[model samples]
Target: MSVVAERPVVAEESRAVRWWRRPWVGPLALVVVVFVAVSVPRYLTLDPAQSLVPPVEGFAPYYPMLVAHVLFGSVAIVSCCFQVWPAFRRRYPVAHRWIGRAYVFAGVLPAAVLATVIGAKSPFGPVARVSNVLLGLVWFGCTLAGWRAGRARRFGDHRKWMVRSFVLTISTVTNRVWGVVAGVVLGPQLETTFGGNEQYMTSTIAGLTTWLGWVVPLILAQLWLDRRPKKRARAAGRSGVPA
Candidate 1:
């Protein structure tokens, strides 16, 4: 009798395991955690002196609004990490829905409203103010759209809009990263270009990074969204399924 060679058996990976193994998921979670840890504590002290953005001279409510905005924004960003986690959504769908409700109602709604108010009167000057206002508006609109889509049971649209909102929510972290990069590049030129006026240098970097932080990520997200359909279509073709 001839001996036949047998193929090695391979086990399929679980959805939860696959999600954890994704290249971007762990790093993204770590970045958000680090950002929240570093940025939230100072605000929690509830001292105006510890405010990241200095209070405007004539704006009596600046500090309060800033505090509210930061706190609510913190909620949005933290909840968003869970909202986007595929494993969490797949394994614990009920928890996912409740968190999603919290993210929308308690997080984005109040935060986005406060963002607009604070941004409109921002002490960072015209450029930074404009960027902040626009960012707030877009963030609010995308979130509202996402929430509506979810309620309507249009999950595909919900996912796309929520992805947009999540990216905007995390743009705060990206803003800091860009701020550091801008500082490194512009710090040396402060004397030559800004006449050693630290305020002017600071404002310029803030304005530039504020725009870059959200816009760049948004553009990348749109590109990814656009390509997803093509990827699905190609996969369908390969599998002899209707696209």
Candidate 2:
């Protein structure tokens, strides 16, 4: 009798497991968590003096609105970390639906509204003010579009719009990162060019980064979304499958 060689068995990974293992997911989630941890504590004290932005003249509600915006934005960002997680969505679809509702209603909606109000009176100068207002509106619009797409059972469009919304939601974190970088690079020039006006220096950096933070990432996201179909078609062709 001839001895037949047996093939080694390799268990296939589940879809959820595969998605969880994607390189970007864990690190991105961790970054968002770290951002929340670092950025939220000051606001939690509810002291107006602890506010990041200076109070605008005659705007008594500025601090209150800032506090609300930060808290609600924290909710939106934290919840959205899971919202974009394919593993979580694939494994617990029911929970996903509920979380999506929370993300929309309890997080983005309120946060965006307050953001718009706060942005309108921002002390970061006209450029920063316009950037903030536009960011708020676009963020709100993307989230609303995502929710409507889901309601209409257009999962693909829903995913795209949600991804856009989430990117906008996290732009604040990006803004801070950009601000720090710009400060480091620009700090030495403050004495020479800005006449030691820290507020002016800060406003300049904030204005530039506020635009960069959302605009750059948003462009990259749109490019990715546009290319995704081409990538799929290529893969399908390689596999002799119809896309």
Candidate 3:
């Protein structure tokens, strides 16, 4: 009857008819990029001295650790891509279910390893340690929360948390994206700021942005998506979508 009354119907129908631009594609491309940019090179070239961070306790004998690192990194990269299937795309609960388990083991687990590998460099400034710890917590916390929410049969909450987790996990891929940009743009200034590890810092900054950029934005997105305007649900039911 009014513009307000007509607005939602138009929005909903428009949303339903859309294609060619699903949210999953961005992350899918990210997964591929991670493999190409980070994983492949790290694998083909196994030099402990060249590793971006110091070796962990078990990750010593850099060769083996590097191999494992590449392996796990691959898992985290791939897992984050499939983590969001049922929503905004054709539902693939069957793949999502199995992939969900692998994600926890692959994606979240390797991140835990990175936490150790990258240890707290408090003297090097808070960014490295803080980022490492926070990244691990985000990866673990989000995945766990998503799992628990789904187990409780709260689908909406589950989806939101899972999206949050996947966003955090994808920071690995995002790190590379930012790393290249910063190095290309700030190549000379890096040695001045972080000593000689300018490229390393660029990479680190990129990885961290995956959290600062994608994950945080995702949380804001969830809040925005969840904010139903209070009246929309009732209106949707009245308009025949059955809420």
Candidate 4:
């Protein structure tokens, strides 16, 4: 077969085996939906001066951290949202690489650093602090791995690492999810209506998000990556090929 004829076949096969088609779409869509749902309120209700947790000073801690949070958060969200879209990956490989780099440098690094530093003094508790730090580190690692994988042309590995990166980045989405749910369900009534308690609601929400947000991605990654060897071994056993 001519190289040109084989190119499309190779690309199609690659995308089919990319592994984001099953079950990954659900959580990624959920995060997007949640992001659109809460973003308007977050912007309209912007008050960067207040502390979601503590270690409050003037603008020293809160503002810088929040700025980093929003900037990096935006990169992470955008990168994650498009990482699995094959059309985008193929049609805009250069753009994808650029965005992916931005996600690592602009998003993952700052988010990890600020999350670690700010988490220590959070009013949410030790569990929340630790979870945030851990999430930050993991997300950073994911981005780094994605970068390395892409550099080495390990495209499948790149896709997997990017999936994990986006999953951790969805911590923001998770935070907002619990914040909204807690307000509607768990919060005390204020004159038979909700009013101006977002920060309070999100206090513990951050920790819950950090810990639980990763559960889906972790399980998916383990199944996707690790299950292959087991499956092959079982087939080998049945065929009596080896071992």
For candidate 1, lDDT tens digit of each residue in 80-183?
99898876786789999999998988899899999888998988778999999999999999999999999999999999999999999999998988999999
Q: What tens digits encode model 4's per-residue C-alpha lDDT throughout 110-138? A: 87777777766566767777877777787
Question: Each candidate: how many clashes?
Answer: 0, 0, 2, 0
TM-scores, each model vs. reference: 0.92, 0.91, 0.65, 0.68
Off by over 4 Å in 1: 1-17
Q: Indicate the residue-level lDDT of 87 in model 3.
A: 48
Ranking by lDDT: 1, 2, 4, 3
Off by over 4 Å in 3: 1-27, 30-38, 44-46, 49-69, 86-91, 121-125, 184-242
Give the poorly placed runs of model 2, Cα more than 4 Å off: 1-13, 16-20
TM-score, model 3 to reference? 0.65
Model 2, residue pairs in steric clash:
none
- Regarding TM-score, does 3 or 4 come out ahead? 4
**Candidate lDDT values, in order:** 0.89, 0.88, 0.63, 0.68
Candidate with more favorable, higher TM-score: 1 or 3: 1
Task: Report the number of the highest-TM-score candidate.
Answer: 1
Rank candidates by TM-score, best first: 1, 2, 4, 3
Backbone clash pairs for candidate 1 read none
RMSD of each candidate?
A: 5.5, 5.2, 6.6, 6.0
